[model samples]
Target: MLRHRRAACYRCLFEEPAEAPSCADAGVLGPVVGAIGGAAAGLALALVHGDRTVSGALLVFDDLRRGADPRIVRFAPRGGCPACAKAPILPSLSPSISPLAAPLRVTETS
Candidate 1:
C-alpha cells in the first residue's frame, strides 16, 4: 500500500474560511467525518475505474480540533498474507454508470 500527504488534496476538499467556526462548534456538520468519508470513497472509485496512479492507500486525519495536518500512511501486507491470498477477485464493471448517481439505500442484512 502507498500513501501520500498531499496538502493540495486536503485543500481541494476541506479548506474552509479562516473565520469559520471550529468543528467542535459545528457538531455533526464538522469537516472531520465528511472529509474522511469523501477521501475513502474517492480512492475506492479510482481503483474501481482502474486508475493506474492509485493503489492501496490510507488518509489519516488525526486531531482536527488541535489544527493538526492530515497525514497519509502506507503499509503493505506481510509476505503470503492469508487475507490477501484468500481475497476473491471480482470482475471489473464497465465505467458507463456513475456510482455516485445512484441513490443510497440502507437495508438490514442477516
Candidate 2:
C-alpha cells in the first residue's frame, strides 16, 4: 500500500458575529439572511482561482451591522471523525482498461 499526502482541507463560514448580542428578542430572517450571505461568499471563493490561504479557516461575517469587523478562525483537524476518515483505496486500472494509462509521445516542430 502506498501512502499519499492528503490535500483536502475543511472550512466553515458563519453569517453572524462570533459574539452573541445583548438583546433578548429573536430577530426574524436571521438564519435566512445568514444563509444567503454565506452562500454568496462561498460561491465567490469557489469561482475565483487564487490565494487559498484561507482554507481550513472559519469566516464570520457581520451582516447585521455595517461597522462591525469580520472575524476569521483557524482550526486543526483531529482524526477520529467518521466523516473525515481516510479515503478508501481505489483499484488501479491497466493501460488497456484506462485511456489515461496509455503512453503519449511528443515530436518537436521547427
Candidate 3:
C-alpha cells in the first residue's frame, strides 16, 4: 500500500507541472490522501467510473499518511537479530528524504 503511494509521490516529485497527465498517471494528484481524494472527488464531478474506489483507497491512504512509516520485520536475521528494512519513502517522515528517492535505513529490530 505504501510502496504504491511512494511510487506515486516519486512521480509527483519528478513530473513537470505543464505535463498534463491521465488519471492513471502517478501524481496527477499528489498521491497523498488529500491530493488523491481531492482529485477523485474532482473527477467524481464528471462521475468517472472508479471514483467509488477512490474513497476506499483514500481510507487506506489517510491511514498511511498519518503514520510515521511502514516497516517489514524479520523475526531473525542472524543470532536472534531482527533485521529491518525501510518501507517506501514518503517525504512526510523526514525532510531529508527526497520525494523521488527512498533512502534505505537497515537496522536490527532487537
Candidate 4:
C-alpha cells in the first residue's frame, strides 16, 4: 500500500541515521532538510489521494520536527484578511514587525 511506501521512505531518510549520528549532529539543518523532503513527498502523495489527507500528513511531519501537536498550515486566511499576509513566527518576532515598528531605529546613533 502507499502508506507502507511512505513509512519506508521516512525510515530510510530519517530513522536509519539514528545509529550513525543523532539528528542533532547536523544542528537544526537535518530536521529542516527532512521537513522539506517530507513536505514534497506529501504533496506528491496528495496528487494520488485527496488534498485534505496529504495536507494533514504534511502537518504531521512538521509537528514531528517541532515536537508539538500537528496542525495544518492554512494557505490563506479567512476572508482574505490582510493581517494574514505576515509570516507565522513560531519562536520569534513576526518578520514584518521590524520595518513597521521601528523603521528609523537602525539609523539612530546610540
- Point to the candidate with the largest TM-score: 2
The whole-model lDDT of each prediction reads 0.44, 0.43, 0.35, 0.39
Per-residue CA lDDT of model 4 for 1-110, tens digit only, reads 12222222221222222223334443448666787688667766875675544322224445445766455433322332222323323213644322221222233557
Better of 3 and 4 by TM-score: 4
lDDT tens string, model 1, 21-109? 44445454556578767867887677677663545444566664467755655444434332233452221342432222223346687
Backbone clash pairs for candidate 4 read none
Poorest lDDT segment (10 consecutive residues) of candidate 3: 75-84
Q: Per-residue lDDT for 38-86 in model 2, tens only?
A: 7657645763655454555555667787757556566555453222347
Per-candidate RMSD, Å:
14.2, 18.4, 18.0, 15.3
Off by over 4 Å in 4: 1-27, 48-51, 54-76, 82-110
lDDT, model 2, position 93: 31
TM-score of 4: 0.26
The total number of steric clashes, by the backbone 3 Å criterion, in model 2 comes to 0
Q: What's the TM-score of every candidate structure?
A: 0.36, 0.39, 0.17, 0.26
Candidate 1: stretches off by over 4 Å: 1-31, 52-54, 63-69, 86-110
